[model samples]
Target: MGRVRTTNKGLPRGLTIKDGRYYHVTTVAPRKWTPLGRDRSQALLAWAKLEGSEPDPSIKTFEVVSLRYEREVIPTKARRTQSDNLKELERLRAVFGRVMIEAIKPHHVRAYLDKRGQQAKARANREKALLSHIINKAREWGYTDAPNPCQGVKGFKEAGRDRYVSDSEFRAVWEKADQTLRDAMDLALLTGQRPADVLKIQRADLHDGALWIVQNKTGAKRAIEVTGELAALIERINARPRERLSAWLIQDDCGKPLGTFAMRSRFDKARTLAEVDFQFRDIRAKAATDTGDLAHSQKLLGHRNREMTEHYVRARIGERVQPLR
Candidate 1:
């Protein structure tokens, strides 16, 4: 028989049986009042075993319910969306400060919702959505018996659709951009493609006076003819000695592949200089939503279903008319 250890709260510390089948107790599970029993303690053990650790299990307790939502869930689903979910989670953890997850109530979530609403509508929605994701994940993973409490909570409403990059803004951005940024922006605009698609384009894909391909975002196969302007852009690019087909065409001086993140600094500076604050993706959406060339724009956008494309156009995009002087 081993010594039965206890916590500061005098609760028996996560107990361990040194029997042939190992049994360990934990209070780390959010909203779980009783300690969890595990035969395989590798996960909790790893945390302890890592360098610069404490002997007490209280270091790992989850009291902040929203923190539990972030840590236990967000990364698993919606992996495609770009967000600093973990960073935001750390902020939550700091605010909650070693509180147990299962110990938290809806009031904690409500406080977060109220504070988030004061910041911005998007901020409120992000917190709420993250909470919903956590709750759903908990239910999915058997952490919670009930469905997520965040399912129907209305935190705030988005005002929406003032974010479009107008035509003059695009032209100004294009004119202001250096060669590297220009080529990068051109691929995004002309192809009506995602930033990743534009950056990852292979030289082999440009042939027959057309930019042909299967789009990675939708997996749709489509082709768009390179008109004289776009063709001229290609000709000038080809005239330069670019990195090999194995490497990305739109690379830095060192020929490293241009990550979307790495180029965003350029986007920020150039858009500011050009006096446009919209995101690069807004350019793609604008191209996709061109009402005059609906069929052609849809093909370029690689929208499999017209309804999906129509919604993206109708709601998210606007005609990029030149700004009135």
Candidate 2:
């Protein structure tokens, strides 16, 4: 009687198409729609499960494994990494959601890279890396026994950023920065820490005649000895008038802890006024290069190896060399 069941004639009862994808329409008074993906075969398998019928043994969708990964594995990563992984997963799901987990091959990954790389090469590389990790996790979770398709597929080569902020450039930005921005800049440069790590610095972290730091990204711990300019800087920070007492070393005018977003907003305004091309993060590289001692810079920057420190201390200006006689 339902108008002779016009479209999708072969579809099972309660399963229908909507907006280019298949959905299972609930039979109850308040109808609920559950997405079963766009592929006919995959959609039918999903409908079979909803109907309490046994699904085919050989068919397991990538969407199934990816959803499981999102529910289980993605939560264990760092906050920023988790955010990035979710975005990458959404993109991957759009292409491979209906494909069988075991059916993905190296060529499929390469094809994805070829297409995605056109828009953002570096971002594509990151997405591919996340996909590789997801597939590996799928294996561990018993979703699929197939080998990772991302393996043997090469990612595009990426060059490290080599923008070195010169002394004049530093001074330009510094002159334009407010007191709060200046404090952040000074701390980042003096401690040779990342912006996130610098923003997390607290009063309790200062002890044992040093400013103790636990890097957010690497979990590396360091105790930068509080002396000379660093000692004076801390004194200056402490002496600043505040309406309310705060534990965080970096606070806004109202004594609220300065967050990365606020700090970045402030930095952007200052950088625009100064007309400088460099970033707030460049201060760390400047610190490493100015230290002039490889070993000392390595320790100061909390790098595990000398080579890693060398990447940060790239010569922005002309390299100094002995003149030929």
Candidate 3:
């Protein structure tokens, strides 16, 4: 005897209403529940595609392709990027979920950008980029033969962040920060690495009088020569006592490695105490600007091109001129 449907009366076969949301129940053993949507009409459209005579007709819809992308592609990205992609996917689904992948055109994409840009221009640009990638993958996977609609649809212009933390501002935060937070900040400033990378540093990464770094975002590798203040800082961190021994350079009182969230929380508290407006990330810009050499800053930041390094240090530093002798 087939499973009796008591609830979800008047809904289509294989679709059930749960907590005021529609879910599609798979026919196979160990059935999976796929969320259709909150809107009844949209859920019905998705149900039709799933139950259609065409084999796996769901692949033809933007929602299904996005699901596949989320499952297969998202996990391979950096942790931060994966988080951002999921948020972008949520926004994209609200707009394009029920639409046929092939039916999407440039105008639809532009319209999305125009509406979403009103709220957050930078975020809209990021979402459009994610959409373009999704469409490209859909084409490659044979879900759609139409050209990517996001192409040539211009995104809103965005300005780069130019906030620079001054020496006094940096000192104020440093004074308020605890020892662990101070170590993290020092590592960030000295190596010019990102918060994630700085927190992941291990004693093993230090060898041959250099601190080796494999950047999480770009996968770029750098071996920063250990000398002067950097060398002393590493020694001090290693000498610090903890309840437990860990290989990680940056650690809390318990000796467990500090994650980004903990680091940010500590930084926020310190920032509040210092009464400074500059962000933790601004320290990177400060490092680049203080270096005062384009080539040196480029190398220190491990940028693929000098242009990127220049952008980091630009607008924060004033031009130096010489008066007529």
Candidate 3 lDDT over residue span 1-325, tens digit each:
8866576534546878889898999889999999998755456667768877323645587887876676568878887898798789879988997789999999999999999999999999999999999999998988878889998899998887878888999999999999999999998998888888888999899999899999999999999999999999988987887898798999998988999889899999999999998877788778888888989999988899988887677767755669999
Error of 1 at 279 (Å): 3.5
- Candidate 2, lDDT over the whole model: 0.83
Please give the lDDT score at residue 110 for candidate 1: 75
lDDT of 2 by residue, 1-325 (tens): 5656667644556789988899999987799999998755567667767878543435577776775566567766666677677678779988997788889999999999999999999999999998898788878877788889999999998887778888899888989998988999998989899998898899999989999988867778899999999999999999989887688998987889889889999999998999998988888888888888989999988899987776667545445679897
Q: Show where candidate 2 strays beyond 4 Å.
A: 1-59, 315-325
Tell me, by TM-score, which candidate is best.
3
Residue-pair clashes per candidate? 7, 0, 0
The alpha-carbon RMSD values of the candidates against the true structure, listed in the order shown, are 10.1, 7.7, 6.8
User: Candidate 1, residues 186-282: lDDT per residue as tens digits?
Assistant: 8787778888778877678877878777765566776778887778877777667645434456776556667777788788888888887788888
Where does model 3 exceed 4 Å of error? 1-58, 322-325
- Point out the higher-scoring one by lDDT: 1 or 3: 3
TM-score-based ranking, best first? 3, 2, 1
